[model samples]
Target: MTTRARPAIAAMAYHQGAFVPFAEAGLPLTTQALQYGTGVFEGIRAHTCADGGKLVLFRVRDHYERFLRSCRLLRIETGHTVDELVEITCELLRRNGTTADTYLRPLGYKLALLPGTRPGVGLSGVSDALSITGFPMGAYTPPGGIRCTVSSWVRPRSAAIPIHAKVTGGYVNNALAADEARAAGYDDAILLDDRGRVCEASTANVFAARSGRLLTPPATADLLPGITRDTVLALAADLGIETAEHELDVSDLRCADEVFLTGTGIGITPVNEVSGHPIGAGEPGPIARSLAHHYARTIRGGGDVRHHHWLTSVRIDQG
Candidate 1:
């Protein structure tokens, strides 16, 4: 049967061994990642860097490092090392000639399938396959700001699953909450922890500023300790904004003067609503704006000298 055509956006994908049109980037129905979410992946971002007058990948190494850790934990073999993954990502972007905001995804998936069959429903460790894909992406909230709801779904406790590994299956839980929000006439969703505490956005880590202190969920809250999350914590310190990470409940979120979300795919998005109540003036706040501006400039190789550790320039071969 002829495959349905992919729109221009997803038609071409960087697939197994090389770039291929979407119709050709096919795998057998028994693929492990397809069956059970036996896969690990990372969401990476490339920003327009002032230093090189080009889009610079932000903390690509860190993301790859985490990727390696995830593969190790998930018992899947990622054919390439973290460094190799970084090289492949940069090359893919180079080929795409993307200069504006772009997103990178490198996934390591189980390959050796068990004889029993069902796509999207298996959970045994087998062999692995690694694939990388890239696309030009725009802003998450477009800086204008967006509203989000506190999801009825709560993040599973650590006893339930590993939140740090970024397993593809973990996001099925995320997608569920996100889909619920859209169905309810909202753009995004926020999840609480199993203990009924604020956790994170459906797809991004959440943060807020109140009493002049920058506050976020402690790593225990089931939120991914995001790379951008780390950046903001340190960025807040540099800006002399007191930063704190602790268990935050819904009341704290509702009463906070300002709220925001952060992730690789969506730098920093203001949270205008929580549990249907409008967040602080219902607009992006001063601290969110400051951090966003500083983050935009910092990722582009500006002001901070010590943070150079976060950036990697695209070094191409002379072939």
Candidate 2:
């Protein structure tokens, strides 16, 4: 019954085109992004390296690439390249004096004040805005593990709305599903697609292990296609564990040897139960634990050399 943790706000944040005091980083109430949820954002994690006390941003380029794609899908112009966004984010962290594990949120949004919901229509004066902010962050999921229930809410299909984009409006559906789960005393909820197949958790990609192999719902299942999920699959393959992408059912989760969720925010969180049914031994399974350990090591600039390519160092000389 524990709630998710959020870091305290930092003193400085990058807003529009300049760094400003966090209190001054405000948008107009009538902005189109606020009015109609026409915004795209990415959540990236930065970690402190034990060696040389360096700070490292994980997968900055990949996140920005996805961010740009999301902006394009929403017709919001970022006006910045992936490299520029990375540099902006790095500068934001540097100016904020970040020294510990932190989370970076970069957002692109339409800033017009028009009232109608017609996207890309009747907007002659609208402009796009971008912002990057960061703060200390910790585990997004509860420790030990979490219990999840299947949400009554179904994921929106791609035809109805581009399901691949991390559009702001779409997350209201996630908030509803998560609120329902929390109200019911569960840690989180698993969403299903229109076809009644397992899609993902409220904010993370879902994975289940059976017969020592890992399986997750395909991208077509309306999941976010998380970077952490990709990292886990790679780590699993390196560990000699097989992985596959396919459709899943709640029964598949209940009967699996292990169940877990992955994301930049949550890392690898074991699911001990689903819909009141205990999964396997009702605890974190061996495969999930191994993947979590490997992920932690890799993110902190440890583990395999190949994994090091994913990190972007933020340690700059202050002199």
Q: For each candidate, what is the lDDT?
A: 0.79, 0.87
The total number of steric clashes, by the backbone 3 Å criterion, in model 2 comes to: 0
TM values, all candidates: 0.89, 0.95
Residue 67 accuracy (lDDT) in model 2: 96
- Tens-digit lDDT track for model 2 on 93-180? 8887767788989889989744444555433456889988888996767658999999999988878767788888899989999999
Candidate 2: Cα lDDT at 212: 92
Badly placed stretches (over 4 Å) of model 1 are 1-14, 19-23, 51-53, 114-125, 315-319
lDDT of 1 by residue, 1-319 (tens): 1112332343346676687764677778867777777889998888766855467789999999999998888887667877878778877766666566667788888876555644344445355678877666666465767777778887877667888779988898899998888788777888988778887887788897897888898876677899989989989999999988888888888889999999887788888777689888988899999999998888888858899878887743323
**Candidate 1 minimal-lDDT segment of 10 residues:** 1-10
Cα-lDDT of candidate 2:
0.87
Q: Model 1: how far is 193 from its true place, Å?
A: 1.5
Cα error, residue 63 of model 2, in Å, equals: 0.3
CA shift at 205, candidate 2, in angstroms? 0.3
